[model samples]
Target chain A: MEKILPIGEYIEKGINSLEQNLSFLWSAIDDGISWLVENMNDLFLAIPFVIILALIAFIAYYVKAGNKMFTLSGLKKAYGLTIFVILGLLLIYAMGYWEEAIQTTTLVIVSTIIALILGIPFGIWSAKSNTADTVIRPILDFMQTMPAFVYLIPAIFFFSVGNTPGVIATVIFSLPPSVRLTNLGIRNVPGDVIEAGRAFGANENQILYKIQLPLAMPTILAGINQVILLALSMVVIASMVGAKGLGSIVYQGIQQNDIAKGFESGLGIVVLAMILDRITQSIGSKK
Target chain B: MADDNNIRIKVEDLTLIFGKRKKEALELLNQGYSKTDILKKTKCTVGVNKASFEIKKGEIFVIMGLSGSGKSTLIRCLNRLNDPTDGRVYFKEHDITRDSNKQLLDTRRTEMSMVFQKFGLLPHRTILENAAFGLEIRGEPKEQRDEKGMKALKTVGLEGYEDQYPAELSGGMQQRVGLARALANDTDVLLMDEAFSALDPLIKSDMQDELLQIQNKLHKTIVFITHDLDEAMKVGDRIAIMKDGVVEQIGTAEEILTDPATEYVEAFVEKVDRKTIITAETLMFDNPIIVRFKKDGPKAAIRKMREAGVNVLPVEDNDEKFLGYVWLEDMLKLEKEKAKTVESALNTEVPSVYKHYTVEEMLPLITGHHHPLAVVDDEGKLEGIITQTSLIIESTRFDDKEMDKLIGEANEL
Candidate 1:
């Protein structure tokens, strides 16, 4: 009877664990879907920014090509300038809704900066040491594949809700790509180039600065671009934890059934996105 | 100790093995396994094997081999770019292999500069900035760096294009920018690994000429690596031909051409035209008659020729020396009323070309002229004679049939 009771208790504990896990997963999905729906308007706002920036860069490229200048002219210059103008316009528009947009931008920017600072070093370390790569890679995979809202609950429990928690959640969401790309870039730098630099009497720092980094710039920039876009995507979802900005505006639009407001904010967000994308692309092309 | 004209680099028995299990691979290779079999068995590769050479100050030494012959690997090993597994390399008697990383860095930054096959120009920097990079890294002031960089750019003939990016330039121009970058460092030693191989033939020739010009002026001790024999002949003071990670021969162009030490060396020089390689200096006879002619005379020429103890005499009509002939033959024929002109009696005439004419150019003339051709100075005075006998003796020594016959006779014994 005693052994049977122990077996019964074990079964009960297993059932309890299963139920808890299932409930946690369900809540995570529910939160993610609702957050995405609420932020649809902010996503729309970011779209125009993206378009405007891309258009500017394209114009700059065209102008440069038309003038027969090897450097930027014609459409290329126009494209770059247009992108800059659109970004400026987005910032100005955000000023009207200043406090909220500023809060969201700050959350996004701080998280991105943290992610970059932490991610790049970690990535380079992993690339340099095989043991570190093996250890960190699985963790990176988990961070990347886990649901965004699932991160918020744990992040909230650790740091609690508000800007800090929001920033933490965004960092967790945006950090993986930066790490992966940094590793890939550093590792992909041609072996001969490194040797050539060494033969030229380049020390470790010189090799990294002159040979590896310059050669790896395109890949590193690409990673940063990915992180930026990912951070922007996470902004509105972060609003659930008291983060503000165009995200809050979108959330209010949804709650009140104000379609016009939703569309306007969505258009603004698009413009911001376009601007970021174009500038990054230009930097990449130049490198 | 720091004289500009001393041996700059000496490498002895340099060997580089890649992968941790190189010994096992080498053992397998020794056991009559193919490269693939060895690789499968031990997963190691040998890059350079016991290579040895020396680079004299101000001399352009070329190391030439086909791909995988270890020429590139050997050059890399010189700067410790790829550390040799065995052997010692000395730079002016300092053992570079034992130098600390800081010392190596200092040596590389100030004493030696390298140019890569791919150019390896930093794409993000302008040509000027790229050229100035080493100076920048060494903490030189921007103004000084810029001045030096501009000077380098001018040296490479890209004076006006300093602001342009590497991508904006053609391949040849990009390579020039690379050259400028190396030159800007003002290093004592320059190592070039197939620097001109990537360019078009015409551009390659131009670059070779440019390199020769630079070497002549700077007197930089250079170790250049190439696969092209013609380029090696043109630029190298001495050439080391490598095969299967071993040097087949190392000597001056004339030595290699005149006396290849090994069958492999002979095979390498076999297809090259010899005439273009042998100079008049190699072909000239030791002694010849010197004569002065006051006028065009058959009798006075005979007297001068007898006094000089030679059949032929050069006819100097003022300061200018004309063709030589047998004065006795001319006088006797004239005395017998059967005389032809001195020009008709002269066996051969040699035209004065530049002093560097190779053996290949002289061979055909020696064969076709039917008599020894006179070697002449730029002033048209006869230097000496380049005879067919000397050419044949120099050439047939490397003939395979002679070697095979000697071996056959030895085997019979």
Candidate 2:
């Protein structure tokens, strides 16, 4: 205890340094938040691309179906999914906040992409080797069990602030489920299937791609669904780090003590969550 | 087809140990060390031990034992699925143990295909896809793969089930799909590890018949593994009876049934019904009384019987073929009835069977009929006699307890 530096001097030094950099950090955060708010129009513009991509996929599938039953089933599914998406849009419109909802959707899509890119390889690597599985498992457990707020703090520290920081926070919060589920899916494929692949003269890579991954697709898709839900939940918490979206509106409503505003924003989130959840679940169940 | 006499797989002193420090531990354990001591010294299990045998080309060579007899492990070792911890496995002229992984894979894909006990169909794939899986992996064109797959499926009597998923098929159908998968590859060697054991007994017998039919057409070298002795006898050209990872005896089915080399083999064979395995050919004498038929006269038949010094003579029609039998009593009766009809003295109660009838079929005829039945050829001519006494004698060939004790002692040595 005597050899350690005095607690008062340490506290004083920390305060002096914090004071010196506090203005810089605050201004950087402000600039990031302003950049996100200014580009809200661009985020809204991306919604048309999603609609176009969906329509193109639907048309491609529709033209390829030769059988009446298949074609009818495809039309039914397409109409059902379209109705779900329209209902979701109506819920957002009902809140009278189209720009904020679009921003939130953009952030979710980007963060989910990032999570998938990082999580899938980790899952594959874990499936390849027991050592990698053992090491990554505990880390995945930690990431999943650690509170969402904890991810936001570190994300804010690293990326400073803004939608990028918010995306980072959401990625960190949602990534674990995808990795864990992918590993589970690959590992749970029946032993006889793997043996059959081997007996068919498949190399390790061939077996992994042809047998393991395809068999694991449903479970992996379920995991992706979980990641989407987790990312949606993080959007509001990310507002505390100066990120804009529906989360910002919710936060503002909270500050001003406006109950209707908070409820509307929250309801919009719920609608978005339900739509994503249903789509992913339908895909998984079909498999 | 390969040369029938050439040895396709020669397993020499093969051993498989499952765990760490396997070789040294297995040696110590084999040297009579206690299990606890062996465990403390080196943690391993002896899955197979010094098993040696040769499977000839185009033969249905069965490896039979109870569960845990290492028969499955031994079959896998031939293809190097469960690599042996020691000794060599030669696939034709090539040493499989020394072959590179690529060579082994190539051999497995092209030279041999294994049908697992559980069928091992890719559950996600339909029957056609499952059957075509091997060809697809080998990079065959989709059209050719489907063509060969369909042909193979048709060969296994599964032609119309191409679109059905594995889950939609019954167990026997799934196993047929597995067979089709193996056949689709057109490999020379087929390894069946209890391939039909999971099916019900009735289905199993049907599958066995199907396998035999396929074997007749393909003449592929097959190494079958099973615990059921009857199944082995029904299908195996030769059999290896294994016990506790050691080969108890390896011989032709007839040789092993008639003369088991060890106590273990004898004990294993004892429970098997002997009559089912032995045939009339095994018990028949080469020479018997031959009688040609011309004129039907009781005095002539009596004179021929006296000259031949036999009590009975087979009577044939004008073409010198089997008509039936005429015994001395029948001849005397006929002599007494010489003034009467010739048909009145014919002894028509002679029981007979085909020369190919197995001992099992012949047993009841001999015991129930109270007479040595004549083994007739395909044309009903007398081939030989298969008596109950001959069958009993054949069965008691391994009855000497001294021989069993000697074998047990030899095993310890």
Candidate 3:
């Protein structure tokens, strides 16, 4: 209020100069992200509806197999999960939002993959080094606490409004929980257990993968579950940047006062969330 | 029984300081500063001092002490789990302390394996997978490693529980899986850091006996760490007693029990019941007076007993065969009856014990003996005699000065 520093103007000038100076690097990143999102979207849409449903059933059945013994009760839960997956898909199709559902699912998945690729290594680095942890922790805190709407402004400037920019914003918003949870999981591994690995002559790499990662897996899977939920929650907000999907349909509903349209697409998103949540939560709880 | 020439592991002046300023602490430690004094000055914890000892091949060398004495740190350093700040460790002839990553990896894979106090089994892994972990890390084929792991599981008496996760098993059974992991590695040296300490006492003892049974067949060089003196005494061929990051004494269990080198060691030895430490070998007097069998008849037996100033003499045949004891009264009576051989005069009722028997086992026999209880070898040849006086002397062999000091300290306590 006193205008002691004029921090906002200073940040604006700094960002302006950064944009001009690093335009080439930004373009390269923008192109790479565009290619990845386009191909992933195509891959998600190209699969037949029947194949997608069967694939979901396969994944659900496989994951459920780990949770149960050879008893009838166990098979009942497994079959229940598979049937639930089929019902959810049919509900989306019957609502006539099946294609939009696929696009939104692809968007959520692509953003999550990119976020994970970046987050997991960063998490491992933070877990391993005090310096990295000190630096990453505050950045993670800032990313998590910032208003989700604030991401779209920077997203538009970086890649201009589209599904690509929308995904970029979603990844940034979803990244922290993945990194934080992964770090916590690795850090929480018992010191004696790691020492036991070392005593048996496991190399640093072997220890990381064979001992640490496997032990840290359940916690990491929990992180992935959070990432999926966060990515899905970003869908409508992303649609505000002209990303096409069920979020755009919801956005159209909000604009023209079409209650039925908003409710249908919102229901479609809910169906997706429930299905994804159940599968990912199952993976985490199986251990 | 440990041979000096067949050393398996030689640890020399090994030291570990835990803190950011370890270099300064180690320097101060070398300059005659105590661990506490150095800690005060540099804020570094001395995990292991300038500790040193050798382990013989096929021997169970135990590092034993109270908590915070650095026994665990010392054992961990042997395998570089807790890296030493100074000194060298040799497995056979290779200096493991300075081994490169590849060399260290090779050494750990092929030459040594470790078992941990808390089991350290992977919770997600089945018992079989946990048992094969060491070999798996070394990149052995699954089939071969699994076969070896199964054998090790059988050896530890956990053969049928292979598919169960470690958490599903009882703690003792889980520890058996841990042991199976080490044994499956098939390495010559085993570093066990308080391996059986977490088990219930009965299971702990059972595991201890099981370890010895496995040791008998495998004869691997084992370095066991424990704070429990009974466990140490029961398993160790030789023990290094540690106190405050320094090794106070290293000796056989008997030597540590009978001749503790420091006051700290004496304090620990004080708690030990003497019967467990003093064996028949310790109590027996070697080469007691005896009458020669074929050459010495009942007449000569009586003369030998009289001259030796004993009521009884152990009679041995020419080949050192134990022919029982000949009592002076019996020999005299037999001589009067014109008995020609010492065999005729020998009582043949003398109770005998093997040299390996503990003094506790010979207490009843020695209490009412007419003569010292004969200590015989497995061949039944008399090796020595355990007199009641000798048993008492050996059992209460503590120095009077030390006992007085201990009593004075106890009063203070």
* The best candidate in terms of lDDT: 3
lDDT of 3 by residue, B1-413 (tens): 34645998888999999999999998999999988899899999998899888899999999998899999889878878778999999988889999988898888888999998888888878899999999999999999999999999999999889999988998889899989999999999999989999999999999999999999999999999999999999999999999899999999999998788988899888878778778888767798888888888887877777787878888888889887887788888888899888676666777899988887787777655566688899888889987665665556665557666766897899
Model 3, position B151: C-alpha lDDT score: 95
Write down the TM-score of every candidate. Answer: 0.75, 0.81, 0.88
Query: Whole-model lDDT, candidate 2?
Result: 0.80
What are the per-residue Cα lDDT tens digits for candidate 2 across B235-298?
9999999988888998877789879999888888888877778778878864566444556577
Give the Å shift of residue B8 in candidate 3: 1.7
Cα error of candidate 2 at position A119, Å: 0.8
Which pairs clash inside model 2? B275-B360, B278-B359
| Each candidate's fnat | 0.64, 0.50, 0.86
Q: List where candidate 2 sits over 4 angstroms from the true fold.
A: A1-85, A148-154, B1-5, B29-41, B286-355, B363-371, B376-383, B388-413
Residues A1-287, candidate 1, lDDT per residue (tens digit)?
A: 44645875685677567556676764564455335434643554556555644555455455334444455444455555555655556564654653455445555666778799999999888877899999999999988888888767655654446555576778888999888998899899877667756766677777877778777878988898888888888877787776667776777788889997777666656656665666566566653
Tens-digit per-residue lDDT, A57-143, candidate 2: 454333333243266766664665656666667667656766777778777877798799999989988987899999999998888
- Residue A177 accuracy (lDDT) in model 3: 88
- Over the stretch A180-261, how does candidate 3's per-residue lDDT look in tens digits? 9899999999987888788888988988998788889989999999999999999999999978789999999999999999
* DockQ agreement of candidate 1 with the native complex: 0.47
TM-score of chain B of each: 0.77, 0.79, 0.87
Alpha-carbon runs more than 4 Å astray in model 3:
A21-58, A65-71, A79-87, B1-5, B291-311, B316-322, B326-346, B364-369, B378-381, B392-413
Error of 3 at B405 (Å): 25
